[model samples]
Target: MNLIELSPEGNFESWEISRLKELRAEEFSKELGQSMLYENDEFRLWDITLKHKERLTFRRVVNDFSYTCITDGFGVIHLGNGKIQFGQFKKGDICSFNMKENEELILDVENTGLGILKFIVTELKLK
Candidate 1:
């Protein structure tokens, strides 16, 4: 299932973590990828690739953003507020979010599937 899980989120049943620590958004780099593909006046493009069980942390301060899935995989999101969620994505799947003023999304994502998870994130700079 291709889904952009948000609003009322849920945790994964197979998620076995000895302890869930509070992840500080400010402490982590806000960059979505290790390398930025492109950036201009109105948009920023990022390529993200995560190996199985690998995790990446980032803060979503921009209000308008979209991500296209390049590989099929399962993911787990660990929010800074102690919330957890499971995301199922497939190749060519696209998810976008447009939040209101003063809204932000901060979380860490982990690839839980057996294969790699890859995606391209595009952040729109609204004037």
Candidate 2:
């Protein structure tokens, strides 16, 4: 199962949290430039890193919800058709998000930015 830690700098929307926990296990993966995963059909976590020094925008059009936590560096989140959430971290901020199906997430990062980490958890499971 994928597990992640979210920053304590900001508050997350309650509906976002609910949606995140409802995401299915098979809907996540690790691909080029993106780190996504699911655990025992209970939890899902991933990180999307921007290795470049330039600002870039990330777009995902899936129902399974996703959120971003600033593990390192700085960034802003823009919600196009869905809700996007965030928290700030300096060098050691630990942030995480739960996943839900069919939720869109967009991330904009500055500099050689570190990616966001997310986690989705299912009931009847232990962390």
Per-candidate TM-scores read: 0.78, 0.34
lDDT of 1 at 26: 59
Candidate 1 contains a number of clashing pairs equal to: 0
- Cα deviation of 43 in candidate 2 (Å)? 1.2
The local distance difference test score of each candidate is 0.73, 0.37
Worst 10 residues of 1 by lDDT: 16-25
How well is each residue in 73-126 modelled by candidate 2, as lDDT tens digits?
544343332334343435434433444544334333334335543222222222
Best by TM-score: 1
Candidate number achieving the greatest lDDT relative to the actual structure: 1
RMSD of each: 3.7, 11.2
Clash count, one per candidate:
0, 21
The Cα error of candidate 2 at residue 122, in Å, is 11
lDDT of 1 by residue, 1-127 (tens): 4445443444433334432432431566667665789999998898889999998865645448888999999998766555676899889999888868878777678899999999999888783
Q: Which ten residues in a row have the lowest lDDT in candidate 2?
A: 118-127
